[model samples]
Target: MSQSLQAAAQRLERWIKEDAIPLWLERGIDTETGVNIERLDVTGAVDREADIRVRVQARQAFFFAQAYDRGWCPQGKDVAQKMLQFVQQHAAHPTAGGGYTHLMNPHYEVIDSKQDLYDHAFFLLANAWSYRAFGDAAALAEADRLIAHLDKKFGAANGGWLEGDYAYACRRQNPHMHLFEAFLALYDATGNAKYLARTAELFALFQTRFFDESNGLLFEFFNDDWTRLADARGSWVEPGHMMEWVWLLDWYSRRSGRPVQAYLDALYARGLAIGQAPSGLLYDVVAENGDVVDTGKRCWGITELIKASLVQIRSGHPQAEAIAIKAVDDLFTYYLSASTAGSYVDRRGADDEVIVDVAPASTLYHLIVVAVELLDHCEGRVQAR
Candidate 1:
């Protein structure tokens, strides 16, 4: 790590800790109903009418739990538990099967009852962290039960899980990536070999299905049989997913002793080469062969890029530190600092115009993760942000 990164991180930490944390805690949660706010308008006012997605609720719970574990907020656990309570109370699938619904209204009604794989992944992740933050036995039990529900509802006869309760024509590696992430978190939180075993399966799935060895890139959409499923735009790739996998592979390697350097190196190189805009922002989507599929950018992708750069810096990549520093600066300048305090610009268009002005609650997970990763990398070298 360079001295410049440490300095830049300290400044970023101040923004995250001193400014952003309090603002979200104060305005992000509904005091009366306990529903996590879905988004904040450009004026930093909460969107009271937007339906809350289960994934957003789960992610906010995870953030609060993580904040508590990291010693950033004293009441973080209480807030996390409150959010968890809201989800469990109202978001359950209206069927006999376990797992949660896809969406809920702010006033505690289930808006969508369809069981979604992506939402359940975050449900497991939130519970995993909830168990870690306070040793909540029920949280661990919920995660275990949810895993069973996933196996029962979404399990694939061939390999990897389905899109939801009903099989979809297009399978996504993104939700599976999140499930891999949740399994890892569960393993870390509980020291359970079963969760780690689950991770191993997902890792193998990534190698055999999600990853493309021919181009050393991961594609987004896939056919029912896990074949490439891009439309007129050729194999569509998200630079953010590439970076996310780089960080995740490093995470898996830490526990499994897997040799994943090649996968990491290839993804990182290709993403930096073809996935970034002139402003250094990772575009929302790109074609397999170095074509820009979408010129738009999103806040979550920037955070993932920062995390991947941080992982590279740890692995002693030559330019990793500099890249991470620039990414951190860009994160604030383009997304975090540019918007209203406690809120962020969600997406920017081709011309770098703010297209979505509300701060989606799901996005807070990405921001908090970047902040936590930075704290881990720069700890002890500098005072707490």
Candidate 2:
């Protein structure tokens, strides 16, 4: 590896080992409950009622699995195993062909049963990671089961998986984007041809169905029949999602040895075209005609941008790296906070109140992952220079 790449990886390792994991372990981890809090305030107070989502659980599990895989957290094997068991016992529901739910009560009771391909994507992600960590056949089997179910239930006639049942039988770009994430992880972990095939198929879906080739932006939200919705709300452009698609496209290209440079460059340009304000933070949504729509700047959007940029940098796109660093710096300066007493709050609400989400595991996990990715990208760039 290049010197820059090595430094970037090192910085990411330090952040994960020093900042992210420790905070999560001390504040988010509920020793008595065996799971984490759903929402944690800036003061590190847990909100029991906020409730954990299966996706959140899966994210935490994946983090732990990563720690194990990289030898960062010793004896991480048992921790990963426990996390898997907790998810299987608490999140998995045996109904309508037995799919996972997003929200669960503190007691691990399923309060919501509606399935989303995005959530399943995370499960597949977690299982794939766990399989890598422990070489667990059962975990691999579970991942395969989830993928099979997704293919049968949510897979659209035109290649991509449908978004889910939320907001009716409507579809969205978000879920398919995440499914690509899962497929990438699955392919890397198991060398599964099916996963790679799914990845290619979904890439086509974006290129043909969702992506606005002329505008260089993705069209979010769709009808059950894969028809694009006409409402401004439906076509809302999220720069963060734009960034994510860029990264995923780059990833898919590298994985399949197919070049999508033009597509990646277009998405990056489009995302940068819709810049943010008050902090240079990317907005949550924009109009179909590229007009700014939703102004709420959430933590997840920033994370996606950072991830996308990092992917670009790592794959020999310095411009993408610069874009990512600016966005991440803005987010860190304005949004991220690490308390003196080891508490952490990664989000603030519209009213400036701490958006204390109890089960913020997924958001937290992605944030850490993105941060690590950015650090790696910068280090690589610095060394290259």
Candidate 3:
């Protein structure tokens, strides 16, 4: 590994060990609720009055699932198993649509019974990863159940998944992207065609509904009929999502050997063009017409951008050198230097002048992402040089 990347990876492992694992083991357990709490304030206290989002437990499952890949800690795997048990016992609810609810109270009781594609997608991701980590059949079964439900309820007549109902049926890129992510994990874990086929459907959905060939960037949202909801509905462009999709696409391309070079290049170009702010921090959303939607600097976008940049660089694009430098510099200034005890403050403006909040889990995961990718990129670039 290159020195720079090795440094990044070492930092990531330290943060995960010292910050994420211990904090969650102590505070996030939520003994009273039997599920993980969503928010822990800066004072290291849980918000007792805050409503729990079921998706948070799902996310924690994903965190532990990733332990296998990084190989830094074994406790994460144990924590993940405990978390899955908590979810199965407390958070899950049966809906009329034969799906699960998105909302739950602080006590782990169902608050909203309406089925949502967003919630289901995260569950699928968590379950898929959990199974991979522990070889647990129940987790795999739950993943398969969610996949079956997605196909049954969300699959469109024309061959793409639709967003499930809370109020109404709509189709959006968010769920499809995550579905692809979950399916990728399943495919890697089980070598199952069902998961691969689902991923293909999601890929087509992106090409048909989300990707804008005219501009080479993705549309933020869409309608049930796959019509462009061109207003603010389709306007919010998250650079993190763009970066994420790039990494995923590259992964798929490598696995399938499908020659996705053109698409990858375009994605990198679009992300760099729109995401970079004056301070070198990546923005959250750039409108469909290429306007900045959210100026607030979140660590998520920066980490994802680093991920994409590394993937592109390692995948044989030396041109990303300057881009990676700027990204690293900006990240250290805006995120890394300010981080405390594994948590990073969300910057409220373009210039990083205001601190909105500190979120540890999200920040820590991004740090891992950037670190691993940078490690890969540095190694690849060093060999090339």
Candidate 4:
């Protein structure tokens, strides 16, 4: 491992162990309910009025479960269990499907009861992580039930799953990407061929629906018939999503022994060319033809870019370590909180100034993904596919 990367990894490890986890454990959780708060103020206080999205709860559960596995938090598993229990009590949908509702009030009353595809995918991922971390049998069973529900209700007439039960003019590839992620998580958690088979189905969807083979751009929105949704600005794409897909593609390659270097190279290269700013942060949105439609930078985008760089390093790309080191440095300098320790600035304006003051607990999921991966890479636990 490069010395710079090792140093960066060690620093990140300390930050997570000492600052981030402790901060969230104390402030991010609601004292009355034991569930994670949806947001935190600039001073690290919980925003108790904000409605809690079940997706955020799932993400926080994922973070805690992952922390337990990493030995970063000894009580992480219990915390995760509490969050899941809270989810089961309040977030359960009224439908027969195994999915949860989209939103709940601060006091755990139902706010938005729609059974959302995105939230379902995340809860599955959370359950997968919980099962992997603690061998929780119920988590595994719940994951299976969720998958069955998805197959029964979410199955679409075209290729992938429907956006949700709600009506929409266009379908989104974002949720499908996350479902692919959850499938991989399930496979890793249980050495099951069924999850692998499901992942392969999503890969096929990628080839025929989400991915544009001619130009290599991942379209975010698609018509009901699975055609690209476009406007005067052209088909909208996200560099962050490209980087995220690159990481997932690399992970799939590691597991399935498939060669995905071409896709990784194209998507990462194009993402950098179009979406990455001069300051090393990634833009929130961009056009297919390389125009920056939105110049704001989000914390999640930088985390995805960091994960992509680590996968590149594992692939033995010559400059990956250097790129990754710089990305880590840039992440701290530009996005993460300097004053607040665990909390982070969620987004930045076009001029690279911090625009968002509130720290949403949901972002901890993104940060933990990179943190654990970087720690593994630096410790030589990461193996090249």
lDDT (Cα, tens digit) per residue for candidate 2, span 1-385: 3444445445546666777677677766666555766766545667666767767777778877887776677745666677668767767766756568777887777888788877887788888888877898999999888877776877677667666656564677787887788888889888878889988888888888789888787888877666688665667788878888877787787678777878877887778777454465677777766676755667777777777666666557757645655665555555555552323445544543445423255665665566556554544532221
Better of 1 and 2 by TM-score: 1
Q: Model 1 over residues 1-385: C-alpha lDDT tens digits?
A: 5788888777767776787789888998888767788888888888888888877889999988998887888888989898888777777777847888887776767877888889889999999999999999999999989989989877888788889966476889999999999999998898888899999999998999888887888888888788776574338889999999998998888887888988999999889998989998999999888888888899999889888988787777999888888888888787885456667788988987888878887888998888877877787331111
Q: Kindly report which residue stretches of model 2 are placed more than 4 angstroms away from their true locations once superposed.
A: 1-13, 165-169, 314-319, 338-359, 375-385
Please give the range of 10 consecutive residues that has the lowest summed lDDT in model 1. Answer: 376-385
lDDT of 4 by residue, 329-348 (tens): 88888767547888788899
Instruction: List per-prediction Cα lDDT, in the order shown.
Output: 0.85, 0.70, 0.69, 0.87
Task: Answer with 1 or 4, whichever has the higher lDDT.
Answer: 4
**Total residue pair clashes for candidate 4:** 0
lDDT (Cα) of model 4:
0.87
Query: Positional deviation of 300 in candidate 1, in angstroms?
Result: 1.1
| Candidate number that wins on lDDT, 3 or 4 | 4
Model 2, C-alpha of 1: deviation from truth (Å): 12
Candidate 1 residue 31 C-alpha distance from true site, Å: 1.2
lDDT of 1 at 281: 92
Per-model TM-score on C-alpha atoms? 0.96, 0.87, 0.89, 0.97
Pairwise TM-score winner, candidates 2 and 4: 4
Arrange candidates, best lDDT first. 4, 1, 2, 3
